[model samples]
Target: MTHSERTSAQSTVDIAALPSVPKVLLHDHLDGGLRPATVLELAGECGYTALPAGTADGLATWFREAADSGSLERYLETFEHTVAVMQTPAGLERVARECAVDLADDGVVYAEVRFAPEQHLDRGLTLDEVVEHVLAGLRSGESQAQASGRRIRVGLLLTAMRHAARSREIAELAVRFRDRGVVGFDIAGAEAGNPPSRHLDAFEYMRDANAHFTIHAGEAFGLPSIHEAIAFCGTDRLGHGVRITDDIDLGPGGEARLGRLANYVRDKRIPLELCPSSNVQTGAVDALENHPFDLLARLRFRVTVNTDNRLMSDTSMSREMARLVETFGYGWPDLERFTINAMKSAFLPFDQRLAIIDDVIKPGYAVVMG
Candidate 1:
């Protein structure tokens, strides 16, 4: 077992029981969460002989180490191999299927996994074809999960590269596939030079169509990026809004004074998809212990925990919860609060979200808490 697994086992709470709790994930990257073994197999299939390790566990270690190198841009370099093999339909389908199965196994009842359609165009497939194949694979995986007594509903958030000019086109594609399982739209890339306002046209298109879209903001860059995502681009959620911590003023006795932007976010109840481990890996935080998740939650920032990249961060929703529990001394109720916060903040319809909360999340947590 991993050190994380052992740490969870030794915590005051039963870490082994975490997987049985239903989870809702809103910020996971489809490309960043590929299985190490799958990455090796996909690399082999594509004849892309550039992997750093011959074995899966070795590759996993390499990914974790490379991501911890104190540079977000360098951390994203690992996606080259995963995206390299995902150019073909078969590869995309298999990877998507595996993503769903893995999430279901980790007890994620609902998830909106994001991926850039523009990245998969190297193999003669259109953006539409990429979405179609991924949706098909998610369906297959969901069916398989249900057959195994785990009901998982997966949703897609079509992502455009922030540095690329395909944001508007991807937003249109997201609308075209909205009823077909694409739940929302997003723009994700390095936040330093590529601000969310660069995709203003895409956000405008989504807004005119009354579609939901989240922005990758308040991560590597600080509140300026987050301000653009919200005050300018109108993001429905702030993907990895960990950097919003910069706006908060904490007194010596633990009193928090919220800035205008932070107050706006809290008053609006805008969800902040806080990926603690990924934040640490991407240098958003020095370590998990230093993360502002508890503070934000205590201040009522609509904080929701997520695994931004499961493979790169070597994390899952269960693992994220366990780490938060270990760090902040949270219990079952706190975990359930995060789950419900994620569920409420989901881009799905109100009825569907409420049904999942009423039928799945609340009941499931009740059972676990009891």
Candidate 2:
């Protein structure tokens, strides 16, 4: 089917079929994707007694409810439990392996999973050791997926906590592992009070080393964070940039005008990693229907869908896409465009990105469209 033909014929999509379509995820957190069962098992192995629930189902419910508190700072507090259990190397490996397998099973063809190395140092493991184990698990999961007739390409994005002082160190670690599995660097945490400019040294270091990095901006804070990230830090992408809508003026007659910053963002083709469910959970948007995803898409911004924290939001790539379909009436062609946007905006080399867009993404979507 041609693009227009598919769009008209498949105006409505079956949410169940979303899992079989190819998807690309650019903004997923490693610590936030852990399985409830694995969290229980790891807590036990690590002798951590801080988990709120005894069983997997109960823990899952706890995480979902706790994260729904509607404050980004409170939402982040749930990570203390997950990070506590992941202090050991074995714990990190198991989480990373399962994360890869889960994403692959959900039909994600390419994913860049990120985690902060500084959060796992309580067990005496160095930064290098932390990254080594996670990489090993991802490789194992890739082989396992291939054996099961699934194809997935996983890359690591080493994240530094925005409130911490080890961003430069983490940036160095990301560069050191660039050839192994690390594709980029990031700074994540509460965006309030801890501005992206605080880590200028790390961003500069990445630039000097000719590395790629994205900043967690415009989620909790607003346009100032995004402006600093793009204009100052030179982030290749904006993580959860839903608030960029603030710079747009929507007229009563349905005309839209973009401010200087918003125009620059659209003009530069800067990708916005918009997470629907997570955005609602953290109170970034009033509700999913109120999300600016459709407005931004209609305005031709480089907006890509993502699952910021799967466990907290109880989301997968498939679920995120389905929510957009339900809320914005997106069809197969729209989903394909979002997937293509993510693949093109990936931190991988140009040739590799092009190869995946041609060989994996286009073919996979073609099958679904037919």
Candidate 3:
């Protein structure tokens, strides 16, 4: 299709006409997406200072506004309040369980939630304890979701703060819990100053142990960081890889032209965890209308949509998908493509991933198509 024709097709798509479709999320942050009510309750129990908002609705709105402040640092500041309440085992378990139930309600069949354990140590909880608590919570939530007739499976990605030197320790922790619930390892923090190279020892340890991991690269930083994450660090997926758009050039008539990096990502079909609203909040991209999702999808990139932080961004997978459809005029087919991208990019073992795709994804999407 011509550029104009494709644009027109996107513009004419309807949102309400879409059916409830199965979704997969691979880049949600655990400490960043807790339910506001859970945060308040945990804060109260832990004697932590509460934010200005008390009720769930008010707290949720407060988080969204803070995350939308158009500065990555400001967007990150919202997590301070959430991490404050999530330092203990009970707090971690409750928040994780609630997240699972919430994601199930949003039609997410599988999700990978990540968080930096180092951040939670301020309350005196050991790293292993933190992981155990979160794991128990996820299992509890999974059971709750299944009991409610909503099937949902969750994997935890233990994140090492990039600015910290504990990535190697976190990597080992992730491998130790691979069977317990943790599926992968990640490095997350301010991306601009601390690049993936800073965590080389951890990446090397993960690589040697044959552990799967993805780095939070190319969100605040640019293509160079993304390239290092893939080439040097050997990431299985990319988190908030919105800046990949920086490498692509658009023609005067709006046709896309890919640079070497963009072409490599597309040809390899590397999974890009693109969070639309979160991208806007971080100033990673100017606007949702200008999000690289439509551009990347059209170019056949392995692009999946996500809510980086549900509470912080006040978003769910359904809401994020709906926003993309409304902004880019996506149809049911487009949504299906994104779901497939996420499933294909999941950190599950090959057999498990295939099972989810064949038994869950295809069948569910078929119903949506019908």
Question: Which candidate has the top score in lDDT?
Answer: 2
Worst 10 residues of 3 by lDDT: 10-19
| TM-score to native of every candidate shown | 0.96, 0.98, 0.94
Q: Per-residue alpha-carbon lDDT of model 2 for 248-272, expressed as tens digits?
A: 9999987999999999999999999
Q: Looking at candidate 2, what is the lDDT of residue 216?
A: 95
Q: Model 3: per-residue lDDT, tens digit, 1-370?
A: 8887665554454454332568899999998888788888888899987577878889888888888888898999898899999888889899899999999988899999999888888878899998999999999999999999999999999999888889999999999999899999999888988989888899999989898999999998999899999888888888988889889999999999899988988898889999999999889988989888888888899999999988888888888988987787777667877888899899888899889888988887666544
- Which residue runs of candidate 2 sit more than 4 Å off their true CA positions? 1-7
Query: Residue by residue across 1-370, what tens digits does model 1's lDDT show?
Result: 7876654544345789899989999999999999999989988888889899999999999998998887899999988878998998889999999999999999999999999999999979998999999999999999989999999999999999999999999999999999999999999889989989888999999999999999999889999999999999999999999988888999999999999999999999999999999998888898889999999989988999899999999999999998998889997777888899999999988999999999999998777654
Q: How many angstroms is residue 143 displaced in model 3 relative to the true structure, after the best TM-score fit?
A: 0.3
For all candidates in order, the CA lDDT equals 0.92, 0.94, 0.88
- For model 3 the local lDDT of residue 231 reads 88
Higher-ranked by lDDT: 2 or 3: 2
Ranking by TM-score: 2, 1, 3
